[model samples]
Target: MESAFTKYTPTEPQIPPMCITLTKFLTTRIQETYNVCKRENPTNIKNCLTNPFEARHNYGLDNERNELIVYRHDIIGTFNSFEGKEFSMSPYTISRYEVIEKLGQGTFGQVFKCYDHINNRFCALKILKNKKAYLRQGLLECATLSMLNTYFDSNNDRIVKMYDHFMYCDHLCISFELLNQNLYQYAKERRHIGLELNDIQKKLIQLLEAVECCSKAGIIHCDVKPENILMTENGELKLIDLGSSCFENYTLYSYIQSRHYRAPEVVFNNRYNNAIDMWSVGCIIAELFLGVPLFPADSEFDLIVRFVEMLGMPSDEIIKNGKIADRYFKLVKRTNKYRLKESFEFEWENNIKLPPHKNYLYYSSLHDVIMKNPMKLSLNTKENNFIIRECLLDLLQRILVYDPKERLTPNQALNHPFFTFKNINDITPKDFYEWTPPEREFPFKVYGHSVSADPEDMLSDAFENKIIINKKLTNSEYYNVFFTLLQAGHVANITIDNPFEYGSITPKQFIRVFNHQFSKPSIPKVSTDVPRSFVAQIYSVTDSFNSVPIKKEENPLTIKHCNQSKIIIHRMTDNK
Candidate 1:
């Protein structure tokens, strides 16, 4: 049998700096691996390390722990194949941890339910893919987790407790205390019928406290959705998946958060801060009650449209300030105000059609969605229902504001009436709750653009305020052809004089670009029936000009995506 004290060291000459912190961990794991391997396979211990998969099969019958040795050499130099970079789910001994089964997978990598031989407990071991980019993100998560766990939640109460982090071959492996299940799964189990008010309050209060703790640490959990929040064995909540988190001072990525919970500022690609997280909180709270997403949008375009339908058009200043504002809103030359481009206009621009059952097409307002929730019928009385609904609506309105500056902070939200547990005896229909809502404001100048104090035109019910497009423009005519060219500033002007002669023009005669300066810039008009070639050229010119690099900036205070799998790996604990 191989010596129980034998330690298999990596043949790779130069180890990366990231593995330096794992020296002590690696030493302990090597000792544990050999000891476990010797006990499990005394006759042919050496052969187990040679091929761990075969070892797993050999020991499957006898060894109850199903122990199989995994060495640094097994994973480090392995080439990625068509099957992909995932390690097998057999009871492989990754360091000192004995993998029981695969739990879940996400953008980073797969998670495994493992038994810690040294600690004599179960844990969720997150195995990041061996790619360098994933490695960097994994390191950031480890650093953030280390900071939060050691400095803030040493008791393992608020944030998910990271037991240990180390390098297993080229993969960055992080072991976390086993958690029960995520909040999403919790909600799903209930058929998304919405949680009871009492239960909702308890979870919301706990989650708010967690958010406040992170805020105090200057960390922005860029992703704060139902899936990332895990429930403890005691039924308490702990925020997980800090991989997307970054310090408020040094916001790394602009593109953050899931599409459903994304803040309006983030959607606009404008400067954002911790308030963005608060926006997500409001969405979550609403979902907890409604049993469905408040704003379930198909795309970014659909999302903005929903925002308008629910809240209304943002102040003209905000509309003008957004980086990609022009994509969704058109500046009315006469009014000098921004109008949300008609849904059909976006369809024309992107060449993608939206389904009829979009949320915006059904829901009239944000208030309407909340008030009409069927879950409220479960309340004992109309008075009780009214109190609960009013309190929630008031809180949500404050958090889901268009401007982040106007949105409630985590601390402030904790103090809101929604979190206040009122006695049922004190509740009376005559005594209604009322408080002055925070005045919407844009206090700071953005990109040399002054805040528009045009209160008269600030908010418009989008359902009532509709932009009529020409009836002659059919989807087929606009679908396969034509792009937009900017007629914003003084440049070369190519005006199609006669709409009737558009179809007769050949490909070469399509664009007659000449230096025809107008008294003022005009919004480019889409012809009813322009040839595809002419439309394409105009769009091509617009794209070239739009490609010019503009300065991109993030909020200095808190400014913190693609839909990765909703399942959270590190927090999956039900397999145990």
Candidate 2:
């Protein structure tokens, strides 16, 4: 074999220009050979082989410029790998808003008073962080805020307005109308300067109006402390912080009002409605008169004690319906033994001198004036304790009724004698503004909705129908209707079978039922029963014999044994 191979020398194949791949493969083989020798133990297969691509670069014969050009693609690709994965700009990011200053920060987000550069408008931008805990809180706040914004925008004037909301990256942003000072700051400044009685009365009336608007919307601002109220640039009052507020239909399992302002019903953990806000209003009104919170207690127990001291011990009826009544009231140590006077004593460290008679006597006298409805005095009264006190007491007492149901509604309060002053019909919008505090500002620049409509009319027209459309028909309607019908002994049993089901009754019929039922003096007592058989339609039978069919046989009359007299009534119609 050696003699034959000696005469034959093989020629090498023609090589094309060396490409990157070929160069890498050749370099890898050379590195592998060196590694195998360095390892010494050739049996190590892993050490014998090396990754060509990962090996250090080799110096090329070509100049630096050429070399740079050759590896340009590789370098660029490595740098650009993260372009789409780690970061990218979204369509909404085309325009950037200017950040003026940070308004406030909470666990979930930070609010910034920003100027929308694109729109040339000021907005409060809420930037929420994307975290599990923060996301949930953000979602809740967003829902509440969105609803509030919609409500205020629909009737914009003095309420906080939401502009827009969006998500950027992991952050959710909500923008609202930028506001100046909250009610807390306003009160602080006023307390330092001292508020006049006229100023106090004006603010109180504005607050009551705002509360009345909320009530009309069927929303209860569960949190109505000074902190939640806001002032605009112009002199007007606006209620804010609807995050803790709830719809009339919402049933909160846990109580959540501020300690000092919390109503007694809330303290006892009893079921409560919008009247909770009235209690807060009463507290605020009392604070305005005394220049401090009326029931500023340290603990829940102390709060209850303070309330009892001022309002007198709650009747057993109230206690039974309260939140912690069983715990605090039932405990003999905390019970009636501690009289109202003792509770009042515990509130203050020392005997504080009361304000001058001229300053506070008016408020004290006015307490029960409205509820009692005493005759109005002529404008030329002597201004004695009896006359002045009657006016003030009447106004305050109506606003501060213990029973929420008995409390004068905002509309009712507006119609009271307090607003029945001289030039009552001549008061202009400008005059109203003049009456408002300079430091206070309306949240809304433009009032979008009509305030002239009757409060009851604000309720959905569907409420008039037996099958209320878009509204929940409470048992209150049925109770009222039943009682009125009961007075007649024999009355129509109106069946409201799914009022929401359209075409069942005309809108006119619905309104008739609603007005008729709602006007009743008392709710009726009626028994209801479920039928055993499936019947899609309901029918009334005054007499069973009238509906019975008679059968006869030919030749001799055959009297069939009558099964136990049972009647089945059916109303067959296309409507069914």
Candidate 3:
């Protein structure tokens, strides 16, 4: 067997200053590389560090522990693959740690179970893949853990604690207190189709608590599948993998949440919230009961169809607002209804073109699917089973609400009778925490003279109040005014026009480049809803512009569609 570490003389190498501050005691060149590695996305962070390079600070003598605290990172020819660690004379030379076996691989790193010589304990060592970007993501995971660690202390076993962090084979490594097989493995071994009610309840309660702690710090475990959950020797569970998480309201990337457990808001492309986590909670619970994914689809279109079939078609407003709706649904102008595009062609032998895409559509009920599918697990007595099944389904519906606004928060799920818990407030974190993220640079610049994205809109259920302003104003200024009306009037979401560059032009932008003045501004008491594309074409003016009367002309203007609801603009008249 290879011994842990080979002797090395104490020395410090010249290194540049780094941005991150994980440790203050160490000063070495490798430390700087660790900092740069953190700025990248975890998946590709290994590509950032190119140089095999100078020695990094891998070990520090701990006076209190009376042992060497090691962080190993070796790259280039010095360190081969993880397989080579078995041959190295000094393999993973921590104070008293012995390498046992490889645990598993993560999104961007590998994990190993090591026996600690000093503490005589087994801990999980996560060796990150070499790359500056991946290093940064790992650092983020550490930061997230750091925040959670404050809530849990040395005695508390509520969650997995990061024992220490170091560099191993040019990869950032985080040490976690050792945990047993995750719930997935346990379920697979014991309960193939579904887990018992009691087990599900116990597991959910602890998992929910972990989620609560994360939300307390405004964290979102974007990936919340069973593989990320580890079980303790006891029945208690621990939520692992902080690497893929982000803050609650904001997202680091659009692609988040595992697809099978993905919430509708995330699927349809709407602004999301912490409720996305609860949605996963529902899927997991149902999967435990049914032994398969509740909503399984190979593609986004199929997923939408599943939802539509189960819950009925969503509102027109929802269909339009969804970023990906047009890809799956066809709008019927005459009927004023949206229909699902042909997901699959049936009656193929007949070559039925007459039926059309809309003709072959039918929606199945949610309750019906659950009962008919292979997922219906038989419980105890029919009476007892019926009651339990009803409660579980109810909980699932609330968590799986299509509108994120209506979806149950983690706290709410705690109170659901499905968990046999009553007071939702019982799970509220004692210490609430949040952080202001750095300013977000514009996501992706739209390259065009006229950006076709949604502009600010002023929509309301009642179009009775119409306050018109000048036809000529900057799009930015119009957007400013759009929000001003909402703040001033107190309104919710609304819709507006979307015609070409402005599509017929939505939230139409009026430019004043013609240099002709208007006949004073007028506020019209508009009726119900504004037509989708309400275009204003300037026709023949009074002969010679004498009778028409022109006010002082302003600068040329460009119209931008207000992405919101219906809004009408007119210059105010000087009349009573």
Question: Quick one: ranking by lDDT, best first?
Answer: 1, 3, 2
The clash count of every prediction, one per candidate, is 3, 20, 42
The count of residue-pair clashes in candidate 2 stands at 20
Please name the candidate that would achieve the greatest lDDT relative to the true structure: 1
Q: Which ranges of candidate 2 are over 4 A from the true structure?
A: 1-95, 106-109, 128-155, 168-172, 331-390, 422-576
Candidate 3 per-residue C-alpha lDDT over 422-506 given as tens digits, one digit per residue, 9 for 90 to 100: 4222322221112122232212121112221322333221122322334442222232233233222211111222111121111
Number of the predicted model whose TM-score against the real structure is largest: 1
What are the clashing pairs of model 1? 272-559, 273-558, 273-559
Q: Which regions of candidate 3 are displaced past 4 Å?
A: 1-97, 152-158, 192-194, 344-365, 371-383, 421-576
TM-score of each: 0.60, 0.48, 0.54
Q: lDDT by residue for model 1 over 1-576, one digit each (tens)? A: 877897878764335332442454345344434544564565445533322333332212112223223422222211221111122111112335666666776777767777777668888888765544565566557545655675556577789988765544335567888998898888778753435666777888889878876766556798999998999888999999888876554455678999999998888888766677888989899887777787888788888888898898899888788898888999899998889998899889989897664543235587877776565223433446766677677788888999877787777776665665555325443333455433323232222111211211211211112122222322112111111111111111111221111221111101121123322122222222322111111113234311112122311000111111111111111111
lDDT value, residue 267 of candidate 2: 80
lDDT of 1: 0.56
